[model samples]
Each structure stands twice: as C-alpha cells, then as structure tokens.
Target: MAEQADHADRADRAGHADRAGHADHPAYPVGLRLHGRRVVVVGGGQVAQRRLPQLIATGAVITLISPSATPSVEAMADAGEIRWEHRRYQDGDLADTWYALIASSDTTANDAASAEAERTRTWCVRADDAEAATAWTPATGRSENVTVAVLTTTSQGRDPRHSAAIRDAIVEGLRDGTLAAPHHRTRAPGVALVGGGPGDPDLITVRGRRLLAEADVVIADRLGPRDLLDELPPHVEVIDAAKIPYGRFMAQEAINQALIEHAKAGKSVVRLKGGDPFVFGRGMEEAQALAAEGIPCTVVPGISSTISVPGAAGIPVTHRGVAHEFTVVSGHVAPEDPRSLVDWEAVARMRGTLVLLMAVDKIGAIAAALIAHGKDPATPVALVQEGTTAAQRRVDATLADVGERAVAEDVRPPAVIVIGDVVAVGPHSAPTTGQDRPGDQQ
Candidate 1:
C-alpha cells in the first residue's frame, strides 16, 4: 500500500510539471511580417475595399480580381493605387503570386483559389474562411517602433472581424500616443493610469494630457473619447482593449496582465481610461496589480463624469438651500444584490441629491426601486447625453417619467442621470412671473 501511495504521488508531481510547462508557453508566436510583397485579392465588395487601404499602406503590390468593384476600388485602380483585373478570377489567378487573397463572394471560387495557391507553394489568405488559408492576417499594427499582431488560431487560421477590430485598436493606440517607442536612453519603465476626463477633451487634466503626449504605449477602452485620441502625436503607440457598447470585451484580467507585461519589458505604459480612474473606473484594480508586480505607477485623476456630467447639463447636485448633500451610485451595478454595497434606502431618505453613472440601461428599474425605497416619485431628474461636448443634450422629467422620456428622446449611452430638486433650477425651468409683470415688458 505504501508503494502504491508513493507511485500516486509521483504521478501527481509529473502531472503538475506537465501543466506548468504548458502554462509557460507563449500566448502567440511573434515576428510575423508582410512588407513589399506581391498579393492578390479576389473580391471587390466592402470587405475587399476595407483590406485594400491597409495592404497599400504595408507597401504590398495588390492585384484585385472581381467581376464588379466598388467605386472606391475602381477609383484606386484609376489612380494606379492597385491593379484591377476587372474580370472573374481565372484558374491560374494564384500563379506567380507570393500571396493570394480569396475574397470572392462565391465559395467555389474561393476554394479553387486556395487550392491553386497551395499547389504553387504560395501563401493564400481565404478572406472569409481564415482556417483554410496558409496564413492569416492578424490585427496588424505599428506604433512608432512597436508592431502588434493579434491572432487566434485553433489549429487553424483566424476570424476576419476579430482581426480587423484588433487592427483598428492598434491604430487608435498608435495615433493617440498610447503605443510609443521606449526611451532607449533609460531602461527603467514607469506606468501612468490617466483619467481621460469626461466626453470633452479639454476637461483632461494638464498632467494627464502631458502624459498622453509622452506615452510610449497607450492601452485605452472605447469610452476614452475620440477627441482625446486626435490630440496624440503621429508616431505614438495605441492599443484598444476592445471595450465597446453592448459588445463582448477583453476580460479585465487579461488587460491587467497585458499592461504589466508591457511595462516589465522596459516600456513606459499608459493605461488611459475615461473619467477619473478612481471614480468607478477600475483604476484601483489595475494599480493594485502593478504594485504587486513591484512596477512603478502613478494615478492621474480626471474630471469625473459623476459630477461634471450633471453640472454640464446645468444641474447642481448640492445647492445652498435646495440640496445639502449628494450621493453618487454606479448604474452598472445590480440594485438588488446586497454586495453591490449601495445603501439605496439611505440614499432614498437622505436630504440630498443622487447622481447615477452607467445606469441609463436600467433607468426604469432603478427609478422604480428608488420610489419603492421611499424616494419621492415627483423628484425632478435630467438625463444628460454626451455631456460637456458639442453633442451635449438633456432630457428633463420627474423620476417617474425620466426613463420613459429618455427612451422617447432616444438619449444614448455615455450619459449621466441626475435626480433631485436642483434639476428644476435650470434656465429652461418655468420663468418667474413677478419679474416680467409690468414695466419690464419691451
């Protein structure tokens, strides 16, 4: 029995060793390249159109074959940007091509092209069927001296949509100075968790904006606002974490891991996020992760949308006599879960105001919950969309009607909802009749 026990222990140790070995494997292979190559694209629709510009920028000699072409492609062909066959792909279309793209709408043509390219020992990209290709286009990106390629291969190729998204993120990161080359003069790496401010780029703190200008690598989410990115230098490095409205995202764990990995590689990393990183931006989590890794990091706060958004819409949470205080809550959290740790009853009864972030989607339910918890149904509320920007708009109503009004007005995300009597003090409020009564009339 003792011999058997020893054997089991040995097996367990071997298993753990094998697992560790697997875990040490890299997430992806590196150093893929496709510069100044001859390539062919088999279609001319929107997808083909999308790939053309990127291919041209990579200095690839692209030959497009299609029965019909989009106006953009035709214009490019006219301008000598690319060669267009203006005919359906022939059997020998893949011949003499270093790389071929099978983007034809017909599946049979795509298959034939793939087979032909394989026979010629040339690389083929099956635009739609990535798995069948000899090589797949990853989300190819270049920021300063940093090049990024994201690929998902399940013993196969990749998904085109996912690849495109990854590429776009990289481009954004680059343009925003989020992806920059490290200072070769210094090997020490530092990190900055910068708040991107509210919707307006002007609201970004001076320090935060300066850091953005100096960023060697920037990793930001969709909410970081486009105007801020527009301010980045041309050679900056930028990366997108794939956080889009109502879309799947790169897990926060993965994002944190990426940030640390890049910083440890001796690159100045900037984790740019919307609004103040401490105001429910999950900046704390990222900071903790960096601390545990012993990486130097600093937090630069921005104007939190929690207060600025409401204020931008001309609604004050606290007034001299109207409201003595205010409460801020995350609409992104569950109202029913106790661990959400929100004191709904206290907030409802407090002689103050309430401001909600990321609660637009659950407005109706939240309003109902608040009323049920003893908050007045008649409390004035204002939904401010794209606050502090040229696109700013507000929908005002009572707590009981604000959600419905928001929907009716088509108020979208990136909005803040303010609930309190202060909303009634805005310029749009009913004018006092006393002042206009007699001699004031023109």
Candidate 2:
C-alpha cells in the first residue's frame, strides 16, 4: 500500500509538469494541403513578394488585392502566374478565403484585413505583428522532395533570423545525405542519361543523385563527376567510356548497343556525362537507340560546362551594359577545316561573350581568324581549366597572345575559353601575376 501511494505521487507530479509546459504556448503544428485551395494575399510590398512564391509553388488559387506590387510581383501578374486585383483590400475579400496574409505598410489597412479574416474564422498571418497574428509564419526549406519548416519564439517576441539560420543548417545536412538518404529508388530494366554538372560532384541535380545511388552499372565519361563514381558501392560496375574508341560511324552505334545490352539484362545503367547531356554529350542519340529497342529511358538535365565553367572562374557570360549576348561555340576542329559550319568571320564582328569548348588545340588559328575578321587584338580572354573542381586554374590573356600564352602555360583540354569585355570584368582580370594586367599568368 505504501509503494502504490509513492507511484501515484510521481504520476501526479509528471502531469503537473506537462501542463506547465503547455501553458499559454500551445502551438498545434499541421501540414495543410493548400493545393487548389483559395488564398487571399493583401499588400504588394517586400513581405508579400517574399510569400507569394511559396503560394504559387503550392498551386494555391491566390487572389492578390493590392494597389501596387514589387517588380517581381508585377512580373508574375503580367505572366498570368496569379490573379492580381489592382485595387485596395475590401472587407468582403476574405469571404471565401481559406488562408489570408496581410503584409501592407499601413497599419490601418492591415488591421481591417485581419478583422475580416477573424469574422470568417480564417487563419491570418500579419507580417508587421507577431503578437497580434492568429498564425505565425515559419521559415521554409526544401531538399530533394522533403520539406523542413522552423519557428523560433523568444521571450520578447519571434526571431526570423534565428529561425532561418536553423533552417539553413538543416537543409545543408539534407543535401549532403548525412541526415537522410534518397526516398525514391531507381529500378532496373532501363537507362538514365544524367548530366553531372561540369566536374563537381555536388552540382548534380537531386533527382540525378537519387537515381545514381541506385545504379547497378555506371558508364562514366572522362568529364563526368569522378568523385561520385568513387562513392558508389563495391557491387556497382564502373566503365570508362573513353576506353571504348570510335573510329567512324560505328562509335555511337557501339555505345547504343552497350546501353541496350546491359538494360535488356535487367541492369539499371547510368550514362554519366560532364555538364548537360543534351548540350554536346550526344545523349539524345543514345536515347534514340534505346527507344528503337523499346527500352525504358529518361534524361536528367545538368548545368552545361559552357556556361558553368566560365561562371566558376568569375566570368559572367552576360553583363548588363557590357555584353548583352553570349554565344557557345565548339572548337574541336580548326576554323579553316571545311567540315566546320560555324561562320567564324560573322561571329568575330558581334560584341558579345564568346565561350569556346574543346578549343585549346585550335585557339591560335581561331583567334587569328577572329582578328583577321576585324576583332580587336587586345580583347580580354580567360581560359578556365578543369572548372568547378580542385584542379581548376584560370589563365588570363588577350586575343592577340592567348594561343602563345596557353601553350607556354601548358593549358590543356576540358577547359572553357571566355572572350569579350566580360572576361576583363571578372575577378581574374586584375593582374595578380603582374603580367600585362591583373589575373594574367594566373
């Protein structure tokens, strides 16, 4: 009887603590399915601009009532992404609203909107006041298909910066796969052509990474993410695509046959190529071959090396008021080659950024062709080798001396050459090596 009394006293103490924790701060967290639901957003300022994207992504039927909106919000309205009413908020605006957000600058307008939502028993969030708001906004994050939201409340009020920081930390863990693995597993009897994004392992898309994790056999290109291949389990087979030589028309045919043969045997084949597979990776041809054999296949787009490599070296392909246009060109063959179809002379006359891939061998003749066609000899140039990787290096030179300098520096293939005034505007353009100008000899 004494032991039973002691147990009852302990249970009573536990119940009191639980009640104390919930006192005046009980928040019921629930994931609302807002798709195809009616949502009314008031104001067109910065706060509304920030919240509108999440609503659009959720496929919410948004009725925006505002006198004026930010440039981004205006663009969305013009594009017909949302229904924008160019007027002030009315009391009847919340009549059918399932959710409401008041972010207007005027406190009077915000108060009026909130009162209407209360009358309708709709959840309302006020950007200007946390204490007065019936609903609090949470910091939102996403990784793969997973969503994470966090809200931090302090003794004084709510702290958004703290919440966002926590959200960012959680997102980083999700991205690196330390916190969770991929949800969808790629099954066999098909092939996936994935763009690995330049030479960086982390740049690949979330879907590409998930599919690759389930690969039974990965046919990898020389430019593909080699680091990712190393991460594969021991059971996975790694095939070097470069080892398979193509002398003539049979080369592509051989690749097609390889994919078809492996997939037919019930293996999940991943054709990992550098940058975007469709750009210059010949991905469509492989897909065609698979389709001819009636094989299941899908293509995942990747960041193209043509643009990404230049950006990695701090060279913007297009700069406002500097270069309004950019063009990607292949220089695997010399300009003088009869088989080359690009009009080199016409390209030289255009004032835009020129990105050259596989051009290290023919750069001298190409530069000469451009210069001969009235391109400036002193046009700034940058060669980004092995871009977006540990072995990356940038060599800055002028159109007049790029070929000679590249040879002198021993710059090799798998490099992107950027030409035009945009090159001079990059961080590497400043002569750190004290050669002619900044970033030269880097």
Candidate 3:
C-alpha cells in the first residue's frame, strides 16, 4: 500500500511537471506588431471575413487565399485593402508568409495550415482549431487612443469558448470607449465599478467621468444610462450583457466570469451599473469575485435611487427635527412572502424614514401591509419617477393614497418612494412635472 501511494504521488508530480513544461512553450506575445507584415488568411466565408478586417486594421499586409471570397472581402480586395489569391491553400502557402490565419470552415484544412506555419517558423492562428495553432488572436479591441489585445494561449488550458466570449466582451468594451487609455507612468491598470446613477446620464460622478476617460473596457448593465454611453468615442466597444427588466438575462455567473477574464487579460475594466454599486448593485458580490481571483477592484459610488429619487423630488430621507433615521428596502419580492426578511412591525415602530426601491408595482400591497402592521396610514409618501432626469415626475400623497396617486401620475420604474415626515416638508403638495422645480434637471 505504501509503495502504491508513492507511485501515485510520483504520477501527480509528473503531471504537474508536464503542465509547467507546456506553460513555458513560446507561442505569441501580447501587443505584437503586425504592421506591414506579411499575413496569409485561409478561407473566404464570414469567419475569414471577420478575421480579415481586424488584421487589416492592424496594418497587416494581408494575402487571402480561397476559392471564393465573401462580398466584403472581395470589396476589400477591389479597394486594395488585401491581396486576394484566387485559390485554395497549398502545402507551401505559409512558406513565405510572416504570419498566417486559418479561418476556413474545414477543421482539417485549418490544422494543416497551422502545422505548415509551425514547420516554417511562421506565426499562425487557427480560428477553427485554436489549440492546434502556434498562437491565437485574442478578442482585439480599440477605443479612441486606446488599444486592448487579449491573447489566450493553449498552454494555460483555458477553455477557448469562454476566452472567445470574454474577448468579444472586451472588443465591445473597446468600441464603447469604456476602456480608457492606459496610464503611461503606472503600468498597473485601475478598475472602477461605477454606478451609472439611477438610469440618468447626467447624474454620473466626476470621478466616474475621469475613470471612464481612462478605461480600456466598460462592462455595463442594460439598465445603465444610455446617454453616458453616447458620450463615448465611436471605436469604444460596448457589450450588452442580456440585461432586461422582468425578463431573462445573461446569468450573474456569466457576468462575473467575464469580469475576471477581462481583468486577467490586463485591461482596465469598468463594471458600470444602474445605481450605487453597493446599494443592491451587486457590487460587493462582483468585488468579492474579483478579489478571489487576485484582481484589484475599486468601487465608484453613484446616486442610488434609494436616496436620489426622494431627494430629486425635494424630499429628504432624514430630517433633523422630523425623521432622524432612515431605512431602505427592496420592494422586489414574492407576493405571498412579502415580509419574509423584514420586521414590518419593527419598521412601523421605528418612527424613521422608509425608502423603497423597485416597489412601484407593489406599492399598494406594501402600504396595506405596513398599515396592517400598525404603521399609520397617514404617513406621508413621495414617489419620484425617472428621478434627476428631464423626464422626471413627482407624486406626493399620504401612505394611504400614494399608490393610487402614483397610478394617476403615471409614475414608472426607476422611481423612488420615501415614507416619512420629510415628504411634508417639500414645497410641492401634489404630483407635478419635474421641470417646475429648481435644480431638479440634474
């Protein structure tokens, strides 16, 4: 038994040694110059078409060899963007090429080309068989004056599918200008998990602005303010991670995985969110995930709907002489189990403020529950929808009447509800167009 144990240990050590050896193999280096370099592309379909433009963009002198080329490739050939060789790849096609790309649908042909490139000591990328290639192109991205290249080597054994998805996300970020220019003095790329400030572009912070200007990739949610994105440079990559309200979305696990992957690729990534990342933004969860992977992350706070919505409508959550304390709650809960985690009775007795987020749909039921739990129905409630934006509207009424008033005012999602004496202190006594109030446009 002891001999068997020794043999098992030896086998494990040998396996580890083999992996280390594979890691040491030279394939492709990051940020390699391809300008004016001879690069041969094999194939003529969409895959090859997709790979060609990026190569051309990098100033690679491209020679495309295929029986037929896609119209886009044909156009590029006509435009003198690339040299189109009207034939299939031959054994010696890569002999004179400095670098080769195999984007053909035939895996067999891709493998053969990769093998040829290797034998000829030429750099080669097998789009269909990335593992068999001498090197692989990462999802390439560029933003304004910034350029980001993500390379996944087979030596690391990272799954190509996950790597490709991550690369696509990075490319999207680069096209969106969310990835800022790299700081020359500091080699370390900074990360900012910015809250997009409750769906209003103007509400984003100055620090957020600075970080956006410097980021190489912006990983933003669907609900994030669109105007903020509009300001980004045209080349900046913007990736939409299936964020939809009351609909299916890209799983949180997928988003977390993408974040870690991009950061690992050494790009300055911004996990842009809809509200304060700490306030139900899941910022802490993402931060923990990043920290676990040994990636540095920093939180850039934003105007959370919890406070901003009420404040925008001239309602202070905490009034010095009136309500001295405040509590924020999530209104998004199962109907049958609405009071599962919260002590409604305790909240009723606290004599403080209650700010409800995502509670518009459940406002009536919540008001009834609070009243049933001994809270006064006469408690003033202020609902501000689309807060701090040009489209903002305010609804002011007692807790007993606020829900009905919200319906009358046509208040929508991204609204904030403040329940306390602070609602009574506001100048406006009824629902009014947000434009009527001073400093409300912000």
Best by lDDT: 2
| lDDT for each residue of candidate 3 in 81-159, tens digit (9 for 90 to 100) | 9999988787888877888878887677777887787667687777775556656676555543556666565456666
Over 4 Å off, model 1: 1-187, 427-442
Number of colliding residue pairs in each model = 12, 6, 17
Better of 1 and 3 by lDDT: 1
> RMSDs, each prediction?
21.7, 9.0, 21.7
What is the TM-score of each predicted model, taking all chains together?
Answer: 0.55, 0.75, 0.53
Once fitted onto the true fold, the runs of candidate 3 whose alpha carbons sit more than 4 angstroms away are: 1-182, 334-339, 427-442
Question: For residues 1-442, what per-residue lDDT tens digits would candidate 1 score against the true structure?
Answer: 9999898888768745753554343234544244766788999988788778877877788899998999998998999989998888789887768877678798988888888886676877777775566666667766545577777644333355787797877666555546554455764687899998887877877667667878678898766756777667677678887565688787899989988998998887888898898998889999999999999999988889888888888887776556767888888766786667787777888767888988888888788888989988999899999898899999888988877887899988888999988888766766444323355432
Error of 3 at 298 (Å): 1.4
**How does each model score on lDDT?**
0.79, 0.84, 0.76
- Whole-model alpha-carbon lDDT for candidate 3: 0.76
Top TM-score prediction, candidate number: 2
lDDT digits (tens) for residues 1-442 of candidate 2: 9999898778668745654553356456667678999999999889988999998998889888999999999988898878999999888999878899999887898999988876677889998876666677789899766899987653245678888999998877666544545436655479999998998898998767767777788988888888988777788888777532122223666778888999999898999888998987899999989999999998989989998998898888976556768989999888999999899988999998999988997899999999999999999999999999999999999999999999999998789999999887756455322213333221
